[model samples]
Every structure is written in C-alpha cells, then in structure tokens.
Target: GAGVSQTPSNKVTEKGKYVELRCDPISGHTALYWYRQSLGQGPEFLIYFQGTGAADDSGLPNDRFFAVRPEGSVSTLKIQRTERGDSAVYLCASSSLGLAGGSQETQYFGPGTRLLVL
Candidate 1:
C-alpha cells in the first residue's frame, strides 16, 4: 500500500511533557526502524522491529524513550519527561526481511516527525 507515513509532521511541547509519535509502514514489509536526528547530525538508530516484536532497542538514550509495534503494522514512539535535548526529527523506515548484496532492497524512508521541546 503506502510507502511510509508519520502523523503530526511537527510537534511543539514544553519540557517535562509527554509525546507519542506514530509511524505507518508499507504493507507486507516486516521490518521497521526508528531513528532520531538533531541539527547537523546524522540519524541515529533508536529501535528496530522485525514483525511485531522489537529485535533491537539498544539505541534508546534512557528510560524516557520507548516504542511499540503490537500489531506489526503501526508503530509508536513514546517519550516521557521530555527534555530539550530530546528535540529532534524522528524518522521511520521499512525494508524487506532479506536484501541481496547486489540488490536494492534498501529501506524506504518516511517524512520525519519534527519534535521541538521548548
């Protein structure tokens, strides 16, 4: 169906508040990923999901950041006690389970959700 879609393209909130970012990935794609990027910095991996379970979550900064994909389709990133440094563009991407070295099973990126914590 769709490539990938994120809701609330922009978010503005005060520090210490909570925020939830949503991501809808392409149908039939079993792999999903989340990333965060600040000014002048490259996207840093936050989490990766294979199917409905999180295959890896080492990139999360602390206990404040969390994500879930219960149904294996839509995913959400939750942040509690948000900080000014937490402000960044949250990106989502999807790719097929396996990619050949010479093939282009590259991950498809979605328009990020820019979160600004004032």
Candidate 2:
C-alpha cells in the first residue's frame, strides 16, 4: 500500500507562469483530497474527489487553480498565471470508507509539493 506521494518537493518559478503538481495516492483509496497551506496557516482544502468525479472544489482559490482525477487514482493540480501569493505547500491525502455514509477517514499527508513564486 503506497502512501500519498508528490513530485518536485520544491519548485521555484517566476510570476505569470504555469505549473502542474502531481500526486499519487495510496492504492485502493477512493477518496482523494488536495489542500494548500501557506506559512502560519492551516491547510485549506482545494478539491476532493470520490472516484473520478470532483465531489468538492469550492476551496480552489480561482480559475487559475484546477485539478482532476481522471482515472480515480493519480491526480494533478494545475496552476496558471502563477502569483507570489500562490507560493505554498500543496498537500494530498486519501482514506478509506467506513461503514458510515461518508468515509470515516483520516488523511495521510504526502511530503508535499512546495512551490516558490519569485
């Protein structure tokens, strides 16, 4: 069972550029979530998916941020028109479904994709 993993643990880019961060969740996980955390702040939920559909995406800051889980496994977060304010740690997590209606789950976080906008 692989835990959540993210690529480019550190990314440095200029303003107005585009970046795509990848996440690989644990096997057999059907619930996936993406969160962004800024300095001295808690992780803000970006999007959540059950299977291949986005169940929640209200946390996305703007149109510049988008994510997809096409196959219901690996997910990618794409950021367009990068801004210095976008610099933060992108975290991905997954969990199992309990007997309850929704998944009674605990998120297992990845090392995180750290993006730096210069």
lDDT of 1 by residue, 1-118 (tens): 6679998899999999999999999988888999999999999999999889999999999999999999999999999999999999999998876655222577888999999999
The C-alpha stretches of model 2 lying farther than 4 A from their native spots are: none
At residue 51, give the lDDT of candidate 1: 87
What are the Cα lDDT values of the candidates?
Answer: 0.92, 0.92
Task: Please provide, for model 2 over 1-118, each residue's C-alpha lDDT reduced to its tens digit, 9 standing for 90 to 100.
Answer: 6689999899999999999999998998889999999999999999999888999999999999999999999999999999999999999998866768375788788999999999
Error of 2 at 106 (Å): 1.2
- Model 1 per-residue lDDT at 61: 96
List the candidates' TM-scores in order: 0.93, 0.96
RMSD of each: 2.2, 1.0
Report the poorest 10 consecutive residues by lDDT, candidate 1. Answer: 96-105
**How much is 62 displaced in model 1, in angstroms?**
0.4
Error of 2 at 65 (Å): 0.5
Runs in model 1 lying further than 4 Å from the true structure: 99-104
